[model samples]
Target: MRNRTLILGVTALAVAVTGLAAPSFAARDKMTPEQRAERMIKRLDTNSDSKVSLDELQAHMTANFKAFDTNGDGQISADEMQAKRQAFRDARKAWQEAKSKDGKERDAALAQLKDARPAMVPGMRPKAFKRVDADGNGSLSAAEVASASEKMFKRRDKNGDGVIDAADFTKKI
Candidate 1:
């Protein structure tokens, strides 16, 4: 009779734990690719114009570059970039460590981290810096940034509509 009571208590605890963890899994599964793209376009469409223009792209890139510069030096050095990368890696490692006790949770955290990795880090490498520097100045100027942004804007404007909207990222159903 005592064994039966202990088994029931353990089963109840298991069910409670499972219920508590289910919502996070469900929320992550609910966002479709189209929804995610729409959210991104909405975010980047700073003027609420429902589309992203070359000017807007350049503005966004300028802001991001300033953020990466960290010391207001008007240039992102190797040390600054390395610091950003290290911060990202450390955060990812801490997240993984926090989930170490639960295999499913750890896997989910890892997958999310992988998906959220920055898209621009590789473009900040030495070769890319040389390409963006344009005049071999060893640093990027506002003009150089605008030029790079123009190239990105052209590439992202897939239909050549002169602006990037959800259509640029979404596929036809």
Candidate 2:
């Protein structure tokens, strides 16, 4: 009789855990790569023209720079950049902590996280800005932003279609 009760308790615990984890699994499953790319394109294509132009990209990047410039100083200082990096790390740690408790699920989640790491992060922003800072001005000007945007557009528009659209994100597989 004791063994039967213990087995029921364990089964109940497993069911509760599984129930709690179901939503996260479902959410992750629903976010396909195409959906993610479309979301990004929508966000970057500010004019809703179904394509991302250099002007749109530059505007977005400039806005991001302003956001990171906590002091409204028109430049991102090392301290501001460090704060951004810390925030990113904290968020990533929280995400990892919220991942599945089951070993297999946890491993899969970690693998997915590794695969989905962004090509650019706040920590890399300073270096990226330096690359964009033409004339060694130590700061990004509007012209530099436009130039950088043009370069980025060229790189992302793999087919050289003059604009970034859904085709740029398509995989050949």
Candidate 3:
């Protein structure tokens, strides 16, 4: 009996050590341009349509804004992000209670809410025009325009390139 207990304790300690050494699931993975484009396409094609029309992209963006823009303002402030998180939690609880929905409807509703926020105000960081002009030719192509977006509530991308995925805003740092 003592031998079995010792073995169990050793196994538990090994498992605990393994868990501590395990890599985080959220760590970033390098993606090829094609892979990045595919992810962008997947996100934009919310309706599962093989192709995303301009209007569909706009609609999807609007919904996203509503979820993150808690203040109902055009931009996502820090406070607004907290509020949105709480609201999401509440909605999730309600959704769990219903159990009839797979949360698809809840997600759709949240997306629609964000879409209702005003078109991003002027002078927004990571300016939309900047993002679209990826080659600095001062022209935005349909594909280029599709991927430009805001990260957090501040950093904005004018071009949808995956190169600027880092969140660091400071140039020198």
Quick one: best lDDT, which candidate? 1
Clashing pairs in 1: none
Model 2 lDDT-worst window of ten: 115-124
Residues 11-130 of candidate 1 have per-residue lDDT tens digits of 999999999999989989799777876876776788998899878777777777776677887776667766766766875885668675677777766776664454352247667877
Between prediction 1 and prediction 3, the one with superior TM-score is 1
By TM-score, the best candidate is 1
- Candidate 1 global lDDT: 0.74
Runs off by more than 4 Å, candidate 1: 1-36, 99-122, 170-173
**Which tens-of-lDDT digit does each residue in 1-173 have in candidate 2?**
99999999999999999999999889886987778878878888888888888777777877666656668867655566667667666656745885857777667666655543333322347778567766675655545655666777798888887888889888861
The TM-score that candidate 3 achieves is 0.31
Q: What is the TM-score of each candidate against the true structure?
A: 0.61, 0.55, 0.31
| Candidate 3: regions farther than 4 A off | 1-28, 74-173
Which of 1 and 2 is ahead in lDDT? Answer: 1
The residue-level lDDT of candidate 1 at 30 comes to 96
* Candidates, ranked, TM-score: 1, 2, 3
